[model samples]
Target: MWYRLGQWMLRVILRVYHRAEVQGLDRVPRQGPFLLVGNHISYLDPFYIAAQLPQRISFMAKAESFSHPFTQWFLRKVDAFPVRREEADVRAMRSALARLRNDQVVGLFPEGRRREAEPPTELKGGASYLALRAQVPVIPVWIEGTDRALPRKGRWIRPAKVRIYFGEPIQKIPAGKNREDQERIHQMIMSAFRQLAEQKVAE
Candidate 1:
């Protein structure tokens, strides 16, 4: 299948070129229906995570990425679904929730968009909302050196070291809470990611 081949190629490429180092992979739950939240720095973020993760992860990508026919085909094959970034894309949200309900892994970039620098900015609340709605665990992943591998708006790809760190999943959220409670969950996810990023920086 295309997805399998793509994952294989990614693994080989990362190993050969970047000397990719993945830590705490064992922290990721074997059985999902969980949210995989990570910092986004490059176009390769999703692929790198997918290649290293044992399960097939579905991404909520910006709608524009799906505009081209070939791109759409490839994205869908790799388990990415489009989301309208400027508005609440209810259909995409529902699709993501459905994937979670089916015990699948949903990859989300809480920042909502890729950043050009290391130590990404504040995260949006969508990932938290989805995790709360689905009553699933949130896995925090921190990726390093992706910006250097393929810098923002840069066409060239260079051999750059990349490291992925997976923190333990966040498992607390009260059922049927108010909006404030939801916001707290969002903060918790963001905090976990921030801590992971700081750790990477220290290294």
Candidate 2:
């Protein structure tokens, strides 16, 4: 399958070129449906996480990415689905819920877009909604140096050192919360990545 092939290639390429240093990988749940929330600094973030993770990841990507045939094919091969980033994508939400019910790991970027800024300026509600609705554990990940390898508005692949820190599941979000409560939870998720960045993590 395309997903398997992509994963294999990614593992090799990342290990050989980037010299990726991953910490707290065991924090990821070995089984069952869980959410991987992190800062999206570059296009390579998802692939980087996929390579380091032990299980298959059903990644949630932007809908516009599927507009082209080649892109669509590549994404499909890697078990990734597109979600419209501009508005509330109910269909994508339903699709994500379905995958969660099927007990697959789903990766989402709460920041919505690839941001080079530390502690992303804004966070989206989709991640919080899915986490509460599915009653699944949410693991906060902090990825550094991907933006240098592949910037949002830059081209040309460059070799760079990358590190990913997978923090333990954040129990800040709960069921049956109001809008204000939702925003608080979203901010909490964002803060986790920033907090991790400040910590002295062992490689």
Candidate 3:
């Protein structure tokens, strides 16, 4: 399958060129449904994360990335689904929930889009909402050096060292669907993300 191929190829390429280093991969649950949350700084962040993991991650990607026919085909092959970044995409949310219910890993970038700023200026509640709805563990991941390897507008992927950190799974989202519950869950996810980022910075 293309997903397997992509994963294998990415692993080889990242190891050879970027010298990618992964930490705390064992922190990931060996099986079952979970939400994978991470900072998005490059277009290749999803692939980079996937290459180091033992399981498939159905990442929610921005809709624009699917505009081209070839890209659409390839993204579908890799099990990625599109999400409209401008508004609340009910269809997308339902699809994500369906995947989670099927005991699949769903990856999300709570910041919504690729950002260059450290400590995202804003975080979306979709990940937290999905976590609450599905009652799945949330794994916070942090990727470093992808911005330089394949920058926002760069054509070539220049060689650069990349590192990935996976934090402990967060499983204690407060039980409820209220706005307060969502905010608390959102903060919990972001706080874990910040801790991972801070660890990378401390190195």
Predicted model with the maximum TM-score: 3
Runs in model 2 lying further than 4 Å from the true structure: 200-203
lDDT of 2 by residue, 1-203 (tens): 66677778987877888887788998888888888898888898999888887789989999999999999998988889999999999999999989998998899998888876476767889988888778777899999889898876778768888888898787656667577766666777877887777763433
Model 2 clash pairs are none
Error of 3 at 154 (Å): 0.9
lDDT of each: 0.87, 0.84, 0.90
Candidate 3 residue spans exceeding 4 A from truth:
none
Worst 10 residues of 2 by lDDT: 194-203
Report how far residue 84 has shifted in candidate 3, in Å. 0.5
Report the candidate with higher TM-score, 2 versus 3.
3
Candidate 2 vs candidate 3: the lDDT winner is 3
What lDDT score is found at residue 137 in candidate 2?
79
Write model 3 residue lDDT over 1-203, tens digit each, in one string.
Answer: 76788789999999899988999999999899999999999988999998887889899999998999999998898889999989999988999999999999999898998887376757988998999998899999999899999988899998989999999899997788889988888888888888988888899
lDDT of 1 by residue, 31-123 (tens): 757899988889989999999887899999999999999999989888899999888788988999999999999998988898755555577
* Model 1 poorest 10 in a row by lDDT: 116-125
Q: Give the TM-score of candidate 3.
A: 0.97
Question: All candidates' TM-scores?
Answer: 0.95, 0.90, 0.97
